[model samples]
Target: MRSRWGKARRVSTLEGPAFMNELQRAVASMGPRVLLFLTEEKTVNTVSELRASLPVSVLIRLPEHQRLMELMHKQGFQELAEAMAAPVPRTVRLQSSQDLPLVRGLNYPCVLKPSEKNYEYGARFKKAYKVGSAHEVDALYRKIEPVLADMVVQEWIEGADGDIYFCLQYIGGQGEVVSSFSGRKIRSWPPRIGGTASCTAAWEHAQELSDTTASFFRQVGFTGMGSMEYKRDARDGLFYMVEPTVGRTDFQEEVATVNGCNIPLAAYCHEMGQALPAMSPVSPQRVWRDEQADRWSREVSGEAVNAAALTGFPVVDAQWRWHDPLPWLDDISRRAADRIKSKFHK
Candidate 1:
């Protein structure tokens, strides 16, 4: 980012206090009608804190504070899902050692992930862990003690990575969906435990999933850019809602634009009370991929990635763009530098 945008334009902040100070100074200098794009949880918290004190008419994705909080954490999401009667995996909150008793009743082959999206568990843990038994969960918990303390143990939805699907929607303030799109992940890093590595638009399966996601979001009065993730349980062939990406566009949000919904354009237009921007022709056959993560998934899990199978669909590389090529170059360079640094350290 520093290479792509000069230091004068992009100031990176590592700590919370420094970030808050920079954000405040930026907002103070900015003109009226601030269009804030919040992709991180800390930014959401900061924006929530500054909403009242700001001197401009800011367009925020999360219009409702309480509803936003519910979607930000694993435990809160489970509770919201239960309240909506949505098919969700049963969760046991592991906030501390005292919460261990709750995990005993859970089904084996459960998953453990941080309750909060902004959890700082360091490099010792992956985004999540799949525990084979109660004993394994207990042992893993002991090893990671205080770090995984504020986590949630959820029932594992039995299925391959291909069974994971998502529905992206930009909703209006009245809980009405302004625009929507749907897609499915074919692979994720760490095999089944990490973020989406490769995905493609699913036209045949989009309708049902989009409806389910819209219904869930509307029921909770969510009014912003968001998506709901679902996993098809191989045992019952049911699509259980895993969680939601609320108040911000998801990482794979561009997959939707590639498929022709053009969510970012639609969202911007709607926020400004303008007519929806003219959209590109729907191309539901397009595939989107993060090359780096897909490589990691393939190498780590030996997952078969047969791209020749989808000969007709064009694949959109996440990091590389034909027009804006510098970022991709920088990414590769950074990877090379890191490799050299690691070798030197060794």
Candidate 2:
């Protein structure tokens, strides 16, 4: 990926023995000047484990081991929020069949989610399930409990997908805020409880959002690229923080970059001890869309997929870029293959 300094190199996933060999070769070739930024948990763990042997500095935002443990696990995150006095949905942790009865009195239409959203657990089930009543919760719990090591039942926040908002910020090693940007979701695939498909840059209610995020991170002693997802309750006008995706760049962080602050780039410069780039004044509202997912969302929701309305505002395509077209092409190819396979199986 192109950064302000230059192009960033990516290492493809490899088999165990080959990966170690490649890692040693890459480190030797690149030397100590290279900084490793890990995006996933597995990568983070691997790099951290090998940090003593590696010569290069790993640019991990959450360097504190305890903080990383708390933020990465759902139940740990709830405890962290409570300790910070931050507002989060009421959550009941279930570790075994003995605790299953806790689901009985939970508010109807609550959500059930695995406490640890690790790769294996996520692959086994969708992120979360919404149950309307106790009976439904019991049934779903019975099916998943045996397989899941940990789980939680949380109150479902009532709001449209657009009500979801994010605060993306870069905190320096000294616990200083280098850059911050906020945006609201326009829509998402899978309607509610899905990844963002369409979103826009906005500062509306940003101060409050920024305060909560900054306070939480400060308490946790976190630094580097971090983001928190929140949803504003339409009826009460209060924002409840859903969770924090600390120590990595958000998927739609480009929305913030195009708007004004380039958080990831800012973090890179901060770590390198270079002068930070001046942030552009938050410009007029800009929209970003994952075209394929946004179109699919419209179709599934039975909403008019109006092209004219999108044209009224400046739009940034999330995937398609002239400079980097291969990733988009690969996505298209994979999607096509999936569709063809489905047709044949039917």
Candidate 3:
């Protein structure tokens, strides 16, 4: 991303209200033309007001919704799915310790998740817990009930990491698809219990998955970058909706760029009312890997990179690049400092 823009960039660590103030000042200093891709809940929620106050041409990722960003919550996506008659797993939401019994009726090996990430509960279970039985769910709830007010328990979708497919779309405000991409996970850290470790472009199923995503957003009147993860059930050969990442790009967004679709660029062009870039052929065989996370998964779970993902294909790493050395270098420097500090403590 840095290489495309040259050295002119304004990076900030300030968040919430403070970040909004900085953003206002930044637009004033940088002039009217601005393209924003945001993840912060506070900044996203309040940007429409800021735009209305100033004569600035601002393009943001999410729709102007005044809400904090959360993940795997009891509300939002699940409700949307059910209302629209979409494919979703039966879920048991735990608002308090009293709701623990609600999960007992679920099928064994259910997936347990903290409703939101704004709590200490995420520190222990980074993604979710696949409990093998009712007893295990009860034991885990004893520890989680004290930390979080809400949680989710759903019947486990039977599939390996490779069965996980995702569709990312840049939906225009007037209900048009500006750009879209479809891909699948080859592996995940924590062996299906955590975040993506590696993934590749799903060439064969791209059209179908892409259409499914575009239709989803169109029906809901969503206008922004939206992504939906679907897991293909091995037992039934059906795809179940996992979750929707609304208002921003997916974490593995660059995978689309590597595969010949630059979603960010397309969205920016559309916002500026410019001609769309000529879409090119994707590197269908390329795999994108979070190298560090893959290594961690290997160390902790004896997980190996799928041979299908590597054989006769290029593996694009998450950070390292010849032109963009700073990001990779910074990662190395930070890890080295941490190692030295640990040695001194020992």
lDDT tens digits by residue: candidate 3, 50-168: 54643355556455453213322446667767877878888888888788878878987788886655537766655788989878888888787877767788889999888999998
Model 1 scores worst on lDDT over the 10 consecutive residues at 2-11
The TM-score ranking, best first, is: 1, 3, 2
The lDDT ranking, best first, is: 1, 2, 3
Between candidates 1 and 2, the TM-score winner: 1
Off by over 4 Å in 1: 2-8, 12-21, 24-31, 278-281, 304-312
Models 1 onward score TM values of 0.91, 0.89, 0.89
The local distance difference test score of model 3 is 0.75
lDDT per residue as tens, model 1, 66-139: 76887888888899889989989889988676677888898888998888764557567788899988787777
lDDT of 1 at 310: 36
Off by over 4 Å in 3: 1-14, 41-55, 64-74, 301-311
Clashes of each: 0, 0, 0
How many backbone clashes are present in model 3? 0
